[model samples]
Target: MLQFKLVLLGDSSVGKSSIVHRFVKDSFDELRESTIGAAFLSQTIKIKAEEQEEDVVIKFEIWDTAGQERYKSLAPMYYRNANAALVVYDLTQKDSLVKARSWVEELKNKVGDEDLVIFLVGNKLDLCEGEEDLRAVDTSEAKAYAEEQNLLFTEVSAKTGQGVKEVFRSIGEKLYASKKDEILAKKNRELGNRVNNSVDINAQRPSTNDTTTCCS
Candidate 1:
């Protein structure tokens, strides 16, 4: 069992808790409270690597960080030594994208180019298709940024469990591969490089705009 801490960061209503619930409990609730500091959960995702079965017991450390601007500066503390982070955004709301971008920017600056695995999630996919399309943050824009940052990106609907499994599954694989390389190479620099290559954010989607954004 590999112990990895995965933090979730985004605006309060962006569905960070919902995604964690679906991935960890395999269930969803319409009414859920915004996380104050963080909550920890353990999930065992089976990932096969190098023809051997590996148990990826990610701590699934769902840090439903406070979205209040006052609490914003404290985000870095949660991610300080985390293995991965899930930066979520409400697909139906463009303002959430801006907040997500800022979070990504901070992570990029603090964690260095070679460390930290980021899962750029566009949440509320189920709510995206019906009401509006005038200036929705194109999923592609997030994908492009993830690609540049060498992070993973996905569209998820926490309500329906769509893309929920894939998100955890992929992150688990990357983290596992990283641990294996680091263990075998016996060098921190090499380990970071190997892990960085494991991420192909470009492998995911499609294109961008001046997405409206807000941390509150």
Candidate 2:
């Protein structure tokens, strides 16, 4: 089983905790309490590899951080070794998207891992359902930014459990693929070393059939 540290970041009341709750518990609360410092949760998912017929078990160690300004300083601590991050924004709030972009920038700078998968998520789809005017943030705009920043982007409603499962599933698939690549690279390196060592040993071995006659 492979374990990955994942973190959620966004502005206050952007539904970061709600999304995490929905993904983990498969339920939602209308009056979900705000997260304090950070909430810890874990979920194990089984994903099938695309190329091979094998099931990969991925356990996500989720850190749902507080979105308030006071907790902004502590964000780095939670995401220090995070393999992936979900930068969420509320669909009803335009400023929330701005905050989400900032969080993405911070993660890129602080995490500094090129392989770290960052997702730009728009939450609160329930609020905008059937009321396009209620959406303050444009989907095309968010998606354009995500594309420019090379991020995974999606819109989900935690309340109705819409697009919630796909978010985690995508992350699992990407993480599993990365792990597989790493393992293959390591094995290749080990094989190369063994071949080099064998060559060295053969070169050092003395010739068994020395045919020089000393006294003819």
Candidate 3:
């Protein structure tokens, strides 16, 4: 399986842990407590490749960081070597979106846009249903900003399990596409080396010719 590190960043109560739980366990907790420094979890997804292409499995090593201001300084430690990031925001809180954008900028500066896959996630969709007025961050506005920054974007409700799976699925598919060939080549090289090493060991064993003692 191809493994990648992913981190979540956003303001408090934006539902990062909720999203992770919904995806990994397919469950939700309304009273979920806020994360401390960070939480670690992992989920593996398989992407069905096109015809003649190799099917790939991606394991996401998720670092769900705390959103509290006190923990902000530790954000870089989690996101430092991450392969992907989900910058989440509350759909009902405009300020969360602002904070999300700041996280995106920091990610770009620290992780580099070329090396990282980022998704701008608007969480708490369940709260906005049948109550569009409650949504403080407009979808179009967020989408436009995502497009400008070249990010994958989605809106999800961890409570209702809406669009949650698709978010990770999209990330898996894209990361596989971008890194598959290189990873495959590296795997092949490693396998070749192992085979060669085994052959060399066998060759070093006492040969039948050497085993035959010379007659007096």
Candidate 4:
């Protein structure tokens, strides 16, 4: 079992909590309330591949952080020990993506040389077409920014539950593989210790199985 921490950062009404709910509970709230400080949820994802099959209990300890300025300063605390991040924005709101961009920049600057896997997700994609002002928040904008930042990008809708599951599933698989590698390394170390112990036992064994009287 792997416990992977993930933090979701985005402006209010951008569907951070919605995405979490959609993935974890498989339900959506139409009259949802804004997130308080942060919402935490955990879900395990089972993955199967061609080489081998295993149940990857990737505990997605997700933090649906608040986007309010008052809570912005505290946002870093949630991501400090996170394995991955999903930066979300509302496609119906252009300013939200701008705020999301600033958050990404902050993560980049503060994260230093450590490898941070970030996914740029735009929510409310089902509301893609509308008036000119609403249409301004193009999916390409988020996609371009993610490309520049070397982040995985996707658009989803919590209302319709479209592309919602895939986004987290992908992240879960990634974190699961990373956890599996560590597990395999630990197992190998244990095996090596056993081998060394066996070698020591053989070295200490007395060669008295058969006493042979031979001319030396």
Candidate 5:
């Protein structure tokens, strides 16, 4: 399996932990407490391959980081070598989206965009159902910003599990597609090294063809 580190970033109470729990455990907690520093979780997802017989397995080593200002300094440590990131925001708060954008900028500045996959996620879709006035971040506006920044974008409801699976599924598929060759090449190299280092114990034993008696 190919493994990658994924990080979650956003303001406090934007449902970053809820998103992780929803995706990894298929459960939700209404009163989930704020993350202290960071939490680590891992989940493996398979991406169907049209050109291969076996599905591509991607294991995401997820780091769910705290969003409080005090923990902001620790975010860099969590996101340093992350392969992908989800910058989440609440749809009910426009300021949350602003904070999400700052997180995105920080990621691009610190991590660089070359090999990092980023998603701008607007959470709490359930809150806006029927009560459209509750939505402060316009879908079109967020989508536009996502496009401008070259990020994958989606809105999800962690409580209701709407669009939750799709978020991680898309990440798995995209990462597999982008890193398949590199991952395969790395595996091949490791296999080759193992083969070359293998010792032939049978070859080291004294040959039976040697007829000379040892007791002579």
Candidate 6:
């Protein structure tokens, strides 16, 4: 079993808590309270490899951070060692997307890790279902920026459970793939070291033809 630290970042009331809750508990709250500082949650997911017989168990230690501007300074502490991040924005609020972009920038500059898996998530799709007029953030624009920045992009509705599962599943798949790659690299290094050591031993040992005849 492998554990990963996952963090959520966005402006306040963008349904960061709601998304986490929906994924972890499979439930949604209409009047979900605002998160103060950060909320901690954990969920385990099993990822099966298409080409392999074994399944990987991933345990996510989720930190649903408070999105208020006042808590902005404290975000780094929560996301310090995060393996994956969800930078969420409300589809109905264009400014939320702007804030989401800022969050992404901060993560890149401060977190400073090329291996971090980030998703630019547009939330509140339920609000734009029939009334597309309510959607303030254009999906294509967000997607374009995500592509430019090398981020995973998706829109999800916590209320209707649309695309919610896929978000976490995508994260799980990426994390599992990264872990597998890391393990393989480590094994390769170990094998290389063993081969080198074996060669060194052979070079240092006396050949049978060169051995002295002790009792001759």
Residue 3 lDDT (model 2): 80
- What TM-score, over all chains together, does every model reach? 0.76, 0.84, 0.85, 0.81, 0.85, 0.84
Regions of candidate 2 where Cα sits further than 4 Å from its true position: 184-216
Better of 5 and 6 by lDDT: 5
For candidate 6, lDDT tens digit of each residue in 120-186?
A: 9999999997745699888999999999999999999999889988998899999778677665565
lDDT of each: 0.75, 0.86, 0.88, 0.78, 0.88, 0.87
- Candidate 4 has what TM-score? 0.81
Candidate 4 deviant stretches above 4 angstroms: 49-51, 129-134, 178-180, 190-216
Q: In candidate 2, what are the lDDT values of residues 1-216, reduced to their tens digit? A: 568889999999999999999999998999988899999999988888766567767778899999999988888999898899999999999999999989988888888788899989999998887755589998999999999999999999999999988999999888777778775565466668678765433223322222223554
Poorest 10 consecutive residues by lDDT, candidate 6 = 203-212
Model 6 scores a C-alpha lDDT of 0.87
- After superposition on all CA atoms, what RMSD does each candidate show versus the true structure? 12.7, 12.9, 9.9, 12.2, 10.5, 11.6
lDDT for 63 in candidate 2 is: 98
Tens digit per residue, CA lDDT, model 1, 1-216: 455777888887888878888988889998887666666666767666674455434435556677667677778888888788999988878888898888888888898636578999998888776565543778788788889877789998999999999998888888777677654443354447568887434222110111223532
Candidate 3 residue lDDT tens string, 112-151:
5486899999999988979455888999999999999999
**Candidate closer to the true structure by lDDT (higher is better), 3 or 4:** 3
**At residue 103, what lDDT does model 4 achieve?**
81
**Which sections of candidate 5 miss by over 4 Å?**
186-216
What is the Å distance of residue 83 in model 4 from its true position? 0.8
